[model samples]
Target chain A: MTTNSISIGIVTYRTSLEYLKRCLRSISFQSALDSVGSVVIRDNDNGFDREIIEQAIAASGLDKSLVKVVEGDNIGFGAAQNELMKLSFEKGESAHLCLNPDAALHPNSIENVLEFASSKKFLGIFEMEQFPVPHPKIVDPYTFETPWCSGCSLLIPSGVYEATKGFDESFWLYCEDVDLSWRVKAEGMHCYLVKNAQVAHFVHSRSNDSKEDQLRALPLISAAKHLADKWGSPRFSKDMAKEYERRSGISIDSDSLNNVPRPSPSSLLKAQPDFSHMLVFSPSTWIEE
Target chain B: MRPNITVVTRTQPGRESFLETALFSLSSQLLVPEEVLVVAHVVSSGPFVELENLIGAYKTQFNSIQLLTHSFEGDGRTVSLNMGLEKATGKYLAFLDDDDVFYEHHFSSLVQALEKNDNAWAFSNVVRAGYGPDGNGYSLRERSQPFKRSGYSFLDHLYENFIPIHSFILDRDKCPSEARFNENLVRHEDYEFLLRLASKFPPYYLDETTAEYRIRLDGSNSVLDGSSGMTSEEFMLKREIWVKSNYILDQVRKEIVGWWAPELREVTEKLGRVADYLSTTDLTKRMEEQKKAQAMVDEIWSSTSWRITAPIRIAGSIAKRSPIPKKPKVHSLKDGHEVVNEIKSSFAWKITAPLRRVKDAKLKKQP
Candidate 1:
């Protein structure tokens, strides 16, 4: 296969089956499927819904040899993507696409991104065309340059993936993409927004049930604390904690954040890129339709 | 001992008849106030002259009446109230809108409730009278009976403004000066003031209706008049903005120090964990650190001492790159045979044997 060939990676936990089916159907019709080297799926639920996923794939009528399913314990979103990336790299794939189970790509998304990515010298972090409202990453419409992009749908060159060591495993859910993007920039690489490459991410609706609310709160708080400490601002963490407490009537225990590993000052001293200046486009700039 | 009470009433230019009626209601109170301080605003000297003449007529009937007038420019009820409060020498304080009236037992009922409770203020239920949608006057259209037995719940008060301004009485000494009306707010000043009071000292509730809230549908006297050309959505949106801008939620959250406080604190702790985990401020600080480090490196390189160590640094670099002897790999014959046998016996080799033979034959034919 040529160096421009792409591999798609999807990590599934207890995701909705209907959403997964639609995601697979979108992938089956992609124009770049002919150039797709492999499709690897890591089931974080240890083959809990493997049958249903396999049935969806079979119904899509894509070549069975093109897909590979690996069952394992729930390592988390970032870690599972890392596993898929490793598998794709071992298969000699040049680029890796990290996809959320609930996201579906537009037909020409993969093809368009690859075409644009081939011309760039550094590893390109392609942005997703989020449906309904675009992810609030300011992007230069003409140049496709952005400060940061969501990992819901990202196209990462293998070279860049290896250089940044994938995402920081510290983040189990939210803000992992931001950490990865910053690290990529620190390595003197630019992340881009592919204006035409659209991926409709079906955001998971938050459960109103109080138990589920508590369950969801834990990871988000953990991630926020890790980011604040790693980046060096206790104020951001305190403000966010205060806002959450005001909205939810819950006091945040800041003392628990002491356990999170902080980035050494020496490591921080290596790169001093201004995050605000990373965006090439003004806040008002956005994609039409 | 009877607590001396000062009833401060603010009236607009054209509300002389309503102000007279309000003063009459105070005169009929079972426990009369020590003084009825009327802060009336007039646009021109004509209205002020007319109000002085009207008060002159009431002075013969009630000797405790006092009138203070100002040139009216805008809604300055909060400013007038603060001025009235400064002149108030009574042990207890009460407020009366010129358009609203109190029942005969309003002062007595509130004082009794405040005396029984340790709270700074006390409020009674209020009956609302207004012009109905049909243009006909509706007397006692609604009563604030629900709040009569509400006791003192700061949480409930956060979500609503149940205590009408005129229905409440404050113990002047117990009430903090900061608990006065917030002059900054153009609307819902009463609710904002009550929220501030509730945050520090939750007001006691008397299970009695001792006041009437007169809602002039003509939109002249009432600030919360629904007839002010605002759509229901607009009204609600404005109300929400007022509540948020006044930090009502923040005040209520701060006062959540009772039974539910621990639960809230637990929730806050969990949320704090989430905030800490998701914060990107550390990344911002790292960028700063990086700049400082770069500056230090630049400084060190430009120093004369660094120039003197150039030859030593070059020798160190050469020493760092010096080649080391490679270690020889030792392989056992038994281990090599075992690896070859395992690969040959693997399922993948067995399954692809036919395809491998066909590919080999095809390649031979092509040559």
Candidate 2:
């Protein structure tokens, strides 16, 4: 296993075959093709798309030996990704790319991220470029200091992943990314946004629906309460519950969250990053073109 | 039954014309008062004679005109008000400054509002007439578009005195007898009294411009009189004193309520701590300190020392990276291909070979 080799991990559940094929095709066409030594797909349900994924892999024209699919019961997103990372580490891979099922990478995304990772000594998490509008995890353009980066297409080096122990599995669904990012930063490791390594994420289309999706808020509110309990001020949790109740017109059962573990006092007392210089507005180029 | 209303007007000497206007407005009220108790501060015999003569002339038009004289002293209004409050015999009480006048329906509107809402007190909007910047003549002050009228918020009331004293009409029975003007407060006595009154019952708002607050140009001893010679620091100190006093009185109100509940007492203690913290740290001083610290940071960032140590800082960052752990020896590409070749040759793969062969058949069928 070479230091520059990358292992790609994808977690799929009821994902469209065409989108999966496009994702595989994009990876096959990456600029540094030989650097991607392994591709692991962990299916979080019964292998319904096993044949389809095999057909897509055959169509992608990559090394058939490098591709492997493992099936399991519906654990969760973070849990499934953890399984893939464990597999990648056992394979002696130096870097792991946690790619979302609904996203397709740009042609040079892998090459660009690997280049940047090598220059930085491959110690921090590097988020890939998001198309259309960038993720709202604002960073100072000059300092490269960000509050947190999204988990949609994060590239984690083997060393940092092993050190931070990946995502906290307690967060079943949402805010797991924030928890991971904060934990990584707490260890004095930095995270950066790799602007040139782009991924075209299709999740934005899911948000454009006109109707209010109240059901989706249940897990989100639960995750937020869990986060606030662990590492945030109690007032913040109370305010979040109140605001969600007001906006969604559905009361959250906060009594259920009593069992969540509180964060260590040291983590709670960590100094917050200064966001006074954050640029909240979109640049003119985002709107013009 | 119609309640008797007492019009308590506290006057000082030499404002005869303004007093007459106030009195005339009262005399023309559709709902007349039981008596106009004129608490006059007469420092000399001449002013007393003038006031007595003036009341005597209006005694015919009014049902009763009583003139109670007091010696001129510091903060004569609060002192005379407490004295006049004793002489008031009406079921309802309303105050009027000698320099301000009420509209014809001022007392009637307030009475109706208080009666309709079953409120202990009612207050209306005022048309603030003051000299323009040139000090030439009086004109209506240009109020903000959304004028904040009287409301029933104790927190808002604590921050500001939105209800003018003249605009209020109190139900004498509902007002606690102990709730009187704080003679110590030369400046916000009326505001302080209203705060105490509001703690018991929020004033009902009669949203009508039914009174005129006269602002004199000659720097008279009125609440609206601007401080003439006070420096900014002196003015700020005066404001801080008033704010501190208001906060103390507010805390007292909270403490009285806190006696019933332990939680409330705890909350009040916390609030007191917060207030103490706020008062001890002057915002401007803190801002200046922050500015100085920021300047120091900027100076350091631009200094030659920072520039010279840039490589060392870069080296420090480079040295912080932990060495990557040794990778475990795993199946190489040739070994992986051998496993794939084995799977292709196995019985299960051969059994599933027919299923996998459907792609060519499906393509042939499509053509």
Candidate 2 TM-score to native: 0.41
- Sorted into a CAPRI-style docking class, model 1 comes out as incorrect
Q: TM-score of B chain for each model?
A: 0.59, 0.60
Q: What is the TM-score of chain A alone in each candidate?
A: 0.83, 0.85
Q: For candidate 2, list the clashing residue pairs, or say none.
A: none
DockQ of 1: 0.01
| Position B94, candidate 1: lDDT | 90
* Candidate 2: tens digits of C-alpha lDDT, residues B207-268: 66667666643334353234444577865776676686666665655654544444654555
Q: For each candidate, give its TM-score against the true structure.
A: 0.40, 0.41
Off by over 4 Å in 2: A1-3, A206-208, A212-218, A243-250, A255-261, A269-289, B1-367
Complex DockQ per candidate: 0.01, 0.01
Instruction: Kindly list the per-residue Cα lDDT of model 1 for residues A187-223, writing each as its tens digit.
Output: 7677887766767663322122556655556666656
- Distance (Å) between predicted and true CA of B331, model 1? 92
